[model samples]
Target: MLTDVKRTPGEKAFDWLNLIIVLVITFIILYPLVFVLFASMSDPRKMFDSPLLFWPKGFNLDSYVTVFENKDIWMGYGNTVLYTTVGTFINIMMTVFGAYPLSRKRFYGKGLFTFLFTFTMFFGGGLIPSYLVNQQLGIVNTMWVLVLPGAISAFNLIIMRTYFQTQIPLELEESAYVDGCNDYRLLYKIVLPLSTPIIAVMVLFYGVGHWNSYFEAMIYMSDRGQYPLQLILREILIKNEFKDMLGIAVDSQYADRMIVREGLKYAVVVVSSLPLLILYPLLSKFFEKGILVGAIKG
Candidate 1:
């Protein structure tokens, strides 16, 4: 049975204060997303006129239509899909392989290895040196540049190693060994079967990173044909290359490049972020448990 304890007047006041602060923070955080969504669907003229968008002042689908009809956006979307799929697969596989061994008590040089891995989380070869190395590797301007460098995130590796140690039963490993199961067999047939939650967490983490990444892609990938959706979106947003992207019809009331760009900007935000928003809810159930377990020890 659950019972509620009576609160003092001061405690009640603190609770109310906390609620107000949280509400204010929530509004601040959520307003931009809400405004962008409303502004994306709103008529460009009306969206421009309205300084505060509680909702769309005038409903319109022109921006969405313009976005959907663009060739570069479609090409970028295809490239982003390819990069995200392949990159996330590499991230999960590499993270799993790196972390699984570290989690085992019998692994040699774990202390030294763990120290080296953790050291990287704090320090790295600066951007110019990394770029030089990749240039020498001849992967610049290629899609592989996006996936290969960030294959194993040190922070995520530690979290997963902790999860494997804290969550998976040691007795299970011993039992598998007693049954003459090899390490690979035990991992494939036993450990992995029970690690769905952590794996789901890794997938979401890596998938979102790959989907939203642009800076590295912009630096490493110069070929326009190889650009990811985020890189294209960056060009559209920062360069205001709207005329080339949307090519708004002169006959339309909102054809003015300035007018179209406002709504178009929000639409691009929605399009770029839609996948991540959709992904979170699907993995929400696993995320809470997995992150907690993974982070508990490390």
Candidate 2:
């Protein structure tokens, strides 16, 4: 049977305080998103006239229409989807392969390998050297440059290794070996099936990283056609904002162009963030379990 417990006066006071704090924080986080959404839909003239945006002043879909009609935006969307999908796959595979071996106690020179990997977390050869190295590898200005150079992340590798060590039992592996299972068979059949939480977490991590990445695309790609969605959006924002500041117009109608330009900023933010926002909810249950289990020991 369930019993009701009475709280002390101090406890009750603390609960109310906590609730107030949480509400404040929630408002802080949600206000910007709400403001952006309303502003994007509002008429630009009204938006400029009003400092506060509790609701749309005058509803319009022109911003969304303009954004959707751009050829560069569509092309960039396709390229971003491809890059994020392929890059995340490679990231997960490389992280798993690197982590599995390092997690094994019997692996030779594991300490040395771990040290070398960890060293990278604190230090690097810097951008110039990295760019030079990529140039030497004949990957510069190529799609491979985006994926290959960052295939493995040291922090993610450590997390995976820790998860494998803590969650996977050595006795299970021994039992599998006795049943004539090889290393590859044990990994694929036994280990991976039981690692759904960690895998899901890794997928979310790598996928979001690849999706939001603009710096890599900008640095590596010279071809505008090959640019990712973020890069293209950045270009559009800069072009529009610059044109507005300089009183230049692609069209003779200056007022309409400015309205579209202002609204496009918020529209771009929403569109770019939409994929991850949708994705996180689907993986949230696994994400919680994965982070807790993976972080518990290490």
Candidate 3:
């Protein structure tokens, strides 16, 4: 036989308070995303009339159709996919190569090398100097400019280094050496297999960074053909907003175009963010484990 125990009044009150707080926080976080989604599908005239939208007034695919009608959006998608794929590969390779040596106990002058790497994080030659350097190297206005300059992130390097040091046993390397494995073999075959979590985290980090980046493309790329998705989306949004403003100023008859622009804005946001929203869920398990184990453990 089992007996039921009653909860204390204080504990019940605390639980209810905690639940309320969590609900409030969840609402605060979710409302904007929900609002944007509903607003994009809603009739733009009705949306404007009612600023606070709990649900879509009239649902339609007009906004998405408008987004897809642009040829630039398709081009941007292709270019962004290319940039993100190649950039992330280079980032992972460079980060791993840089961090591995630092993690090794046998590597000489590791402290000095670590100091030099960390120094660049806090200080840099500034934008003009960097641009001048890129110009001298003839990488400006080229696809290489996007991938090369930022191939290795210092923060990510440190995180990976710490992961290797803490998670990978020194004895494992010694065992590999005894099995006639060279440094390269040990790294590719052994270290890499064991470091899946951190590698996945790096992929998510670098991939998203390259996917969402516009500033570098704006500064380095003059050709519209080479522009990434984010830069192209920015151009489209700005052009739409400008047209809306001009139309509103010129004639009241053009006010419908303004409403269309409002819907288009939220549609653009949804399209741009869709990839990340999909990707994060797939990587979430590894992401949490990697950050905690790699960053906090060491």
RMSD (Cα, Å) of model 1: 2.5
In the range 71-178, model 3's lDDT, one tens digit per residue, is 777888999999999999999999999999999999999999899999999999999999999999999998899999999999999999999999989999999999
Top candidate (TM-score): 3
Rate residue 254 of model 1 by lDDT.
Answer: 48
List the candidate numbers ranked by lDDT, top first.
1, 3, 2
Order of quality (TM-score): 3, 2, 1
Model 2 per-residue lDDT tens digits across residues 98-162: 99999999999989999999999999999999999999999999889999999999998888899
> lDDT per prediction?
0.90, 0.87, 0.89
Q: How many clashing residue pairs are found in candidate 3? A: 0
lDDT of 1 by residue, 41-98 (tens): 9988887575999988789988899899898899999999999999999999999889
TM-scores for candidates 1 onward, in order:
0.92, 0.93, 0.93
Number of backbone-clashing residue pairs for each candidate, in the order shown: 0, 0, 0
